[model samples]
Target chain A: MVPINEMKSKCRFAIILGVTLAIGNFFRVPYAFSEPIVFIANDSVPMDSITRKELKDIYTGKTKLWGNGDKIVLTFLKQTDVYAYFLRNYVNKTPTQFVNYWRNMVFMGKATFIPKSIKEEDKLMEYISSTKGAIGYISSNKLIKGIKVIAVK
Target chain B: MKKNRMIINVVFSILFIYSAEVDAYSSDTVINGFITQGYMKTDENNFLTDTEEGSFEFNEMGIKFSSAISNNLSIGIQFFARDIGDLGNDDITVDWAFADYLFYNWAGIRIGKIKIPHGFYNESRDNGIARTFIFLPQSVYSDPWRDSLLTIKGAGFYGYLYGLSYQLQIGIMDAQTDGGLAKKFNDITKSSIESIQPETAIIFSLQSTDLIDGLKIGGSVSKWDWKMDLTIQDMPAKSDDEALLWAISIEYAKNAFLFSAEYSIFDVETPIDLYVSPTAAPYRLPYATNNVMEGYYGSISYRMTDWFEIGVYHSIFYSNKKDRSGKDNVKYYNWKDYYSWSKDTCLTFRFDLNQNWIFKLEGHYNDGFYNGYITDNIDKDGNEDVEQYWYLFAAKLMYAF
Candidate 1:
């Protein structure tokens, strides 16, 4: 048996905590998105399209090698909306949680996947075009040269 | 304080390397580390250190080097040093070193000094700046046992099956002779600990992350064995210990709010075949009984702003499951009943000064001494009395890359 005392104190603390959680959950916190995210990859990628589960796995540092045994390189946009949209839709994690996941993996010595952060759309396109097996997300639906906008099923 | 200077140089090296972008995990071989200086004090009673008087003996610094050798193989290592009151004393040691091989998304193996999965955050417990609290709840993540329980030397298997992720490890204990836990063991035996060596260990971890969005439920079970080398009257004696531990954890994160809870138990027996060997004669410590210890806590934290966060938790622990009253110690050792349990209510305020700097303050209302690793009733001044309740205050400043 545990020896935690003071029943009344526990009740009061629990009430206050419950109320705080309710308020925090009631109001929608920022850093959310409804914008569509387009997936872009290099020509060296094995598959022309990807699935939600597959993308989630790749982003979380679970699947490092592609189906054809090529290393999967990941990239992320510096913008908040596109990053939040992509993560929420498939990865089921906030940006903070996503970063922590990778950090934890690094701390665990996995060193498997550390996504390159790109600041702009043109630079992201140029990098993906030049870098083989690289995949990234952009908010723009317009097609760019030297990059394949892989369909997300 | 020369170690502080060395850590400063190391910190600036990280700063110089990633000046343009504060992303330490940018390159192929990620180089990152953190430096922290902390202050600890208590209204009464000493905690880990001379907390009755404010002390800045709390400091930790570590650096990690990690890289992938191939698409499916990687290796990494971290070097760490710390000082908390009279413990650690800035001893530099290898925190963890491992070579990992990935067969598939559902299967990977780690060989070398693999992590021990106790609770949800046990493997990552030493990453202070990466976490929100200066100290995790004492209910399960006891501070004295931090280094001793961090990792084991052996191999580990981890992967995701269907929606369940699992980590299985088979190894030996990484017992340190002069680490924090060894000091506590000294308190337990009232004798000097010469060394603690590994014997046997096995752990299994399982979690379900797909059952709910932003929610996770996990459990871990482990069996651990170790031998302690002690000196009594200049004669060396060896004692053996066997323990079984298990933990259940639940966490949910939504938006900026996070909630977590865990319950754990440790069933321990010393001298597994007690009194059967002549080597155990005249060296056996009293009260080395088969006992079950339990701990649990519920915590909540919210990121109110980009720069600020707040968290609170109520943690509880018991030294013995069958006798929560702890009366036996009084009958045999003339000790207080409260020595067998600990209850703590903690609050913390964290401020992220910048991407690379962090500051935080914390306060705890403590009700017992068992979880504090306080076995002796005497203070540093040899006072034989103790307080039933006390307040502990702590603050920390950290720089990380």
Candidate 2:
């Protein structure tokens, strides 16, 4: 019993609402959306910034010692958006490739330890803050106090 | 065989206890293991087993433990067992045990039984989970010669220099000829060969990883001297020979695609006097003076999805590079038509059932017969006769953690 014009407008509104809901569902997954990754280090470390190549070398166990001859401690977040971003950009490798590389390194006696994988952001931040020569990454917005930010050059 | 089974049981028991102990001590300790069971069959010839009627003799299992004893020192050991047709025979053996000391990033030393770094895939050859194919390219990594090339009992110096990673190993290997090589020699000379032992061996390899992202180019060279004692027509004979092996490899991986290629040559030289019969008129056996084996293969793989992958490769091997046509050797030795080379084209499919399990199916179209001894493809009249062209199908299930 509705007018033809009103029915057409209601139909249009329903279609728009359906499309909006679909888009919302698509973006609801946080990992589907890209986010910037920020590298953090212990405050005791003198270094402020690291080049992309150096960062790659560090994560791959190529550069094991810091400039001051302290053993470099590596930590990582377990399969987060920031971890994926770091692996893709800084390491220039996919997550699977990075995992395989580390496994090979460990089994071949090229490395002694894989980077410590932390699931909680608070634990990662605390580990970075307490350990000397430690390096890790988190989302840019999750930067915490007591840890120094390392600018990626 | 019972003794071998007993040894396997004991080894597994020890491994379980050790794994538990290590787990209790530190969570950092990693205990990784893999088990793969495979089936293979050929149309006419017995390719890697008595596979004329589909064989299930191909199996591999391994366990390893790695622990960091100190900040800069770590120790690792692996126990492995394999039964590939009749080659491995279900014998449990210590694959590798090493202690590594890292003085610096540019310098490290590994002491103990160390895995030899040969071609690009030799180090991880046994780990089916890490490779695209159930069987690696047999051209460069011949199944018959695995024990000789698997590991060395000595120390190796591995480090990075000027952006180049290098490893040098000087060791002595006790190469056993209880496998196909012995059978081949016995078939040729009507003799029983006990073993072939290497007095000395050296291996050197170098790789460059910084030149390109996800690209690795490397080369390796190995030299060894071996001595063998055999009975020819119930008479004892001794011989010594020197072998030289070298290979070049290139691999590139980008996103979901991977490409790899390797070429290798193996050369053996023996004194003509060693082949001569002391009591006979002629001083030399009917064997070629210089024996050269060469091969190359190229492969490409694509990951269609997170759980599925497909790959194909073409591998060619020549038992004697100088006689590519295989006519000269056949005429001289009165062997089969395709005895001097093998051309293998293979297709493979891999399914990642889960994070810890994998299943693989592979098909191969092969032309020529270089592995008749390993496959036991001898005719009833005790002659080397096999089909020139054949097909092989293989399936493997693997689990790793």
Candidate 3:
């Protein structure tokens, strides 16, 4: 007979693996748009590249300030396919879960929440250009003149 | 003491204003608010309210004002009102008012009245639009103790580590003498408890945020001293003791599905020694027992469509960890076995009517009566038996911006 402790450990690992596999299979749908989106930041932002983890931190309201202590303003997107794709690929949350996260942050003294229901690419670019330390995701084709694109590592 | 608290709050408000004046700010003011109304009915138990008659006394409303003063500073305040059973009665009160200053990406300090981050959902439990269920699992999130567990009138600090986040708080619990906690204790000891006072508590929380995508593992521990004053018969009695609670939590989300689980332990010393019966045979206290409570729950939800979702959770609670059955109570006071534990299974359906409106309906199958539920029917019928099985139905509608 297998040892009880070893068997329990193996069982735990199997459950984890099964759940991961299920998530992978369930999220295998193709992106709604063929062209990938790019992250755009304010021109005054000092950093031109960000790690995946850092991007997640900014979007989730964990990293409230930049390296030089400038406040970071987040851009909220309309509930569209692009928003869903960004939440899944970058933030690693479902759309509803992400919205819940935002609501929690807002209720817990995150005073800077200004939800921009901007679906037009021009409006997003304008908001990013006007607001310092602002970051958002837009289609590569919509990367306008005022905003600077940050490469994701 | 009340005057001192008022002065302290006013001082904090002044400090927030001075900080804003000294710092160069982007100057953006935002106003946000929400309202929720609910209907509930229970088949057997009163459930802390008169829900047996399909009561519509469950409702809450809140309005908040917040502003970012500068790159490193922000201030916010909220006014909240609610009517649950006989509690609150739509009394407008300040929910949370605080000033937070960020020193670095890994360090920040917050002062003034702030929400206590308990379990996974305590901080946002009042935000109905953010939750999928009409009621969070009662095993972990007891509504009767909300007055004591909601917020603190002190300060704390928070930060992020390598792949985890941590928060440490040192604060005194808001001492509401006429809260539901006093009522529950009164019922427990067969006395009229007037006040429940809590010592300055220390709460520490740690959670893994980046270890796995869409997965979070967390733990929290809180310790505090407690004192209560009660009147049994025509005599006044009081006792001071200590209390401690801790919990471990795990949550995961992928695609349109979410799964969460939590386990908690609450250890509290009882003050029943003061409640001696004057007319009993030995003229002694009935139940002189310390309570080591245990609770746990597991839940899952699936978003079937953009506007429709369904969820389920099963919760278990025991009033005493050592005596899972009420054999001690039966030997001491003859209370039934089911008085020591409760098991609840719930199914909920949620509909997002629009961006600002949501509606939810839920049903519960409850076994046992230890979940702060009281029944007067048994007394009216002059029976010794209590309902061992019962059901509850709840519906809620909310609008938020």
Number of the predicted model whose DockQ against the real structure is largest: 1
The candidate that wins on lDDT is: 1
User: DockQ score for model 3, please?
Assistant: 0.23
Report the alpha-carbon TM-score of model 2 versus the true structure. Answer: 0.86
For candidate 1, what is the lDDT? 0.76
Chain A TM-scores of all predicted models: 0.82, 0.75, 0.73
Model 3 ranges with Cα > 4 A deviation:
A1-34, A77-79, A94-97, A111-114, B1-27, B272-289, B375-385
Separately for all candidates shown, the number of backbone clashes (residues 3 or more apart, or on different chains) is 0, 1, 0
Candidate scoring better on DockQ of 1 and 3: 1
**TM-score for all models, in order of appearance:** 0.89, 0.86, 0.86
| CA lDDT scores, all candidates in order | 0.76, 0.75, 0.74
State the lDDT at B82 in candidate 1.
82
What fraction of the true interface does each of the listed models get right, in terms of native contacts kept? 0.21, 0.12, 0.29
- lDDT by residue (tens digit), candidate 1, A57-114: 7787666777676678888887877877777677766565466557656666666434
What tens-digit string does per-residue lDDT give for candidate 2 at A70-98? 67888888755677777767775555556
lDDT of 2 by residue, B1-401 (tens): 67886787776677666655654223266776667789998887887678898989998878777877765688888788888776778877788889988777778889898888889888887676657798788899887677778888988998875568889998887466776556555644456776677787899999887577778899999998877777666566666778899999998977666889999998977432333456765355547557789999888776654466677777889888988878777776666657788877777888777656789999887777785563376688876558877889999998664
Better of 2 and 3 by lDDT: 2
Per-candidate DockQ values are: 0.37, 0.08, 0.23
Q: Across residues B165-197, which tens digit of lDDT does each residue of candidate 3 receive?
A: 888888988757667666666555657767777
